[model samples]
Target: MNHLKALLIKFVMIAVVLIVVLTLIFDVPFMDSIWTSLVLTVLAYILGDFLLFRLAANRSSQNVRNMIATGGDIIIAFLTIWYMQVALVDANGSIALGSFIAAVIIGAGEWFFHKYLDGNVVSKNTRTTADLEADYKK
Candidate 1:
């Protein structure tokens, strides 16, 4: 089930990217083009998620990892929103708005997927617990 969710989320993300790319080919404004806004949104999300993952993986304790991951997800949500507002969004800025909406839309699904994969607690210092906690916070 967890694997399914991850794959699903990944598929959706890719689909959105493809849609945006297609729109960009027609000379759509940055605000009107789904591709540019989505690309920037994805860039922000990827960076934010990577940071959270690294923080979780490198933390000293499992509990800390959970906290970091949770915090990271929250950060991703807000930062993406900020990204949309920065006028860096193309195509009348609506596409950027859509990108922000998209992140929050799928965040819970991804978080749940991650948590399901790490539900078992092994030890405070082990990777499983840490991974689980990271999932929980998200």
Candidate 2:
């Protein structure tokens, strides 16, 4: 349930951001941009959010873990945008600018999304009542 909620939120966030950025800023076709956003959102949720967050769980600090996950998210978003531009957009133009812009915008939203996941989903197991009490003392 938690995973599904996170995935849905992620999909909606990515779709909105990418649709606006790709269509308005990059001049990508609206339908193509929507398709690209959907594909990228799913891939990013799997690779960036799910897998990277799992990997970051081993880290001691929640802040550090979130940072690592955000980094991975940016990379995944960038690659996905670039690939979509190449394959779907079919433009001879360089994708660097569009990819970078989209990645940065998506990455900003991802940081907050990751924070929500950390609080609501990922940190639940690690944050026992005893742990909360201990932190309160400090």
Candidate 3:
């Protein structure tokens, strides 16, 4: 239930940002922007948010962890949107600009979302070996 809620929030946020950047700002097609947004959202949620959080293992400060997650999101957003723009719009100059804009926007949202996940989801879902051992002893 929590995972579904989180995914829904992420999807809406990503879709809005992509729509505004691609359709309103860069003049890309609406449907193409939506498709690219959905793809980026799912990929980033899995690869950037979930995977990176697991890899970090609560080893760093929340800010640092968020940075790492956001960095991954930025890279993913840039690459995915750039490719989409190039293929769909045949855009050369706008590709880099649009991708950069989308990345920055997504990165900001991802930072906050990472914090939320750390507080609500990841902390609930993960436990260290020591924690498990202590629980067994109890």
* lDDT against the true structure, each candidate: 0.46, 0.79, 0.81
Per the 3 Å backbone cut-off, how many clashing residue pairs does candidate 3 have? Answer: 0
- Top-down TM-score ranking: 3, 2, 1
**Model 3 misplaced stretches (Cα beyond 4 Å):** 57-60, 128-138
lDDT of 1 at 58: 38
- Top lDDT: which candidate number? 3
- Provide the lDDT at 2 for model 3: 78
lDDT tens readout by residue for model 2, 1-138: 888888889888888887788888778888877887888889988888777765664434667767888899899998888888888877656566778888998999998998898777775565434356556889
Query: After best superposition, candidate 2 residue 133: deviation in angstroms?
Result: 23
Candidate 1 residue 91 Cα shift, in angstroms, is 1.0
Candidate 2 ranges with C-alpha deviation above 4 Å: 57-60, 126-138
* Pick by TM-score: 2 or 3, better one: 3
Error of 1 at 59 (Å): 9.6
Q: List the residue pairs that clash in candidate 3.
A: none
